[model samples]
Target: MDNKEYIASGILELYVAGSLSEKENEEVSALIQENPELLAEVISIEKAIVQLTAAAKKDATYSFNDIKNQLKDTETKVITFPKPNRKQYIGWAAAFILGSTLLLSVLQNNSLKEQLSAEKQQLEEQINKSSNSLADAEKLIEVFRDKDIISIPLAGQTVSPTSYAKVYWDKKTNSIYLDAKGLPEPPEGKVYQVWSLTLDPLTPTSLGVLDTFTADVNKIFTISNANQSEAFGITLEPAGGSLSPNLEQLYTLGAVAS
Candidate 1:
């Protein structure tokens, strides 16, 4: 609204350039009618531009009419540029379509590859689980094999007659699978120790103590027995079992028939 602010806004320069928007042109026209001083200032600036442009145009020597005549022949000469024929344009269109289709196909192939990888991993996990189940079943089958296995039935002693155990002695492997299905778990801090007894001298050799006695689901233990013995017995002495069978704590006794 102020005279100094209006001149500094550069809107007047655009008005002189004939570049002001239609709404701006009408507003400036209204302002010129109201402000005589602003109107006089615009006339003086326009006159100076007219004089400067005329002088510059005179020095150029090329008249606008001569330039017009030169432009008149421009269309007559018809300077042709090399452009693709219709076939070439069609070929380019086909190539662009093919390229886009190929790119889409590659992305779809990659997605399918990822899906196949996930399926392969799933199949591998399933196979591993199946293999484990098969191995466990095979182990159960081997435990009951009649050949090369001496089954020693351990009858419960006077202390507990209901508690029975079967020792499947594998002489070839020097190992025995003691199935203590009928035996009750010993009290806390106590374990059952096994012994190999020779009938003649009554000499005894200590085998390993049963581990995980309470938590064993099948209550079957595979123990090493490289001894030439006649009888087997189990005794509950302490948590780690005893060096010698606690005669007082003997639970079960069984003899191997000759």
Candidate 2:
């Protein structure tokens, strides 16, 4: 099945929930590695599950500590009875009530503890995401500051008048860091493909496809480009990309400076 059909099959949700069999899990894992869009979908499903779990935990109505304190503050009254049988019956009733209260208190406390633990886990995850984002920003700043990096600005083309993107090419490393933050998300079953162009012959070579555009938080992707490219262009194509550039779908283009 195609990536779009596979993603819409609801199997990713089951995979995230750990309901799939081991063999199925392995198959999904292999597919995720081969397809960026599938991996993105899986990650999205997992994040949704985490958010729902956190919300349910937050909605817990009772506080275990508060209930415990209230029980402790309650005053107990004792009365002397003229009949021994009546006194004995009252004592038994009191014991039964006390037992039920303690049992309930224990159960509630356990539930509260579980909720508290879940909240803590969610907090940790948020902190980690923040830290990772900060690290990425710092790394990008360093790349931009490098003296050897070539910055190329790709302007919008006829197909997309408002879309724009930038390329940071590191010739020393034979790689390019594409900043596509200004481009719109590709429609389902479509992806943006990058091309390395040699203007002398006007030949185009495929660099790679951005299949994870919808899932990428920063819209920046790293692709290997060892070609002696004189220009760069981005075109929207069907998922998995096209063998050759489709000029009709060209969204952005920029030429390298001498």
Candidate 3:
């Protein structure tokens, strides 16, 4: 047979897989030595098998020389038969190896698809989170630029001389955005409380408590306030917040412009 016809017959694949009889193996080995093309084809088949085995068994190691040695070391059993068709035996062996290799390829492809799907989902979630944060920041910038919105700077008090905060009061919406980025995290079992103050009688109304201070990424909070606030104050209080402000624990205070 010509080189192309012999290679296409699939006997070389069975030879590389160590499925041929002793006499057949000797004949193939002699042919391989005489023809470089046949030797190259055998090496190519061995390499493909090594790659597939290595991918399926990630922790295992394989080498071309190992497969070559296994081919030489294979022992063929001589079974007594009235009339054994050597061609039929070799063809069946080649078909079985090809089917197994195809099955392995399919399984590996499925595993890769599942892994890619999970990674794509995680990437999409991260993108959505970043987009929402950007939208909120844009809205805040617009509010700060409004003509009716009040901007109040609360300076540090005696309790925390280096701390400061800012209040952006949207009176039309009765909402205030508090930027408490300058303040330190409160101690355990304690929280920061915001108060709207009236200076005439010095009456203080609790706006809300910063219960999520440590967990807030930007140190910014939104609170609803409908009181006629003449001033703003922040003080450290117990976990659930107090009905009244603690003057001694005041961290920052500011007066609203008339």
What digit string (tens of lDDT, one per residue) describes model 3 on residues 1-258?
A: 899999999999999889999999999999999999999999999999988876877676667887784575467645333343677876766776678768878987997999899999999999999999999999888988999999999999999998999999999999999999999899999999999999999999999899999999999898999999999999999999999999999999999999
TM-scores of the models, in the order given: 0.50, 0.64, 0.65
List per-prediction Cα lDDT, in the order shown.
0.83, 0.92, 0.93
List where candidate 1 sits over 4 angstroms from the true fold.
Answer: 1-134
lDDT of 1 by residue, 1-258 (tens): 787788778777678779999999999989978987778878877888788778776455666887774675444434233465766686776777688779979998998999999999999999999999789768867877858788899999888778889888988889888888788988888888899999898887899788688888778888899999799999887877777788777788899989
RMSD of each: 29.3, 20.9, 19.1
Compare candidates 1 and 2 on lDDT and give the better one: 2
Sliding window of 10 residues with minimal summed lDDT for model 1? 73-82
Error of 2 at 47 (Å): 38
Best by TM-score: 3
Clashing pairs in 1: none
Residue-level lDDT for 26 in candidate 2: 97
Question: Which stretches of model 3 miss by more than 4 angstroms?
Answer: 1-90
Score residue 66 of candidate 1 by CA lDDT: 71
The backbone clash count of each candidate, in order, is: 0, 0, 0
Better of 1 and 3 by TM-score: 3
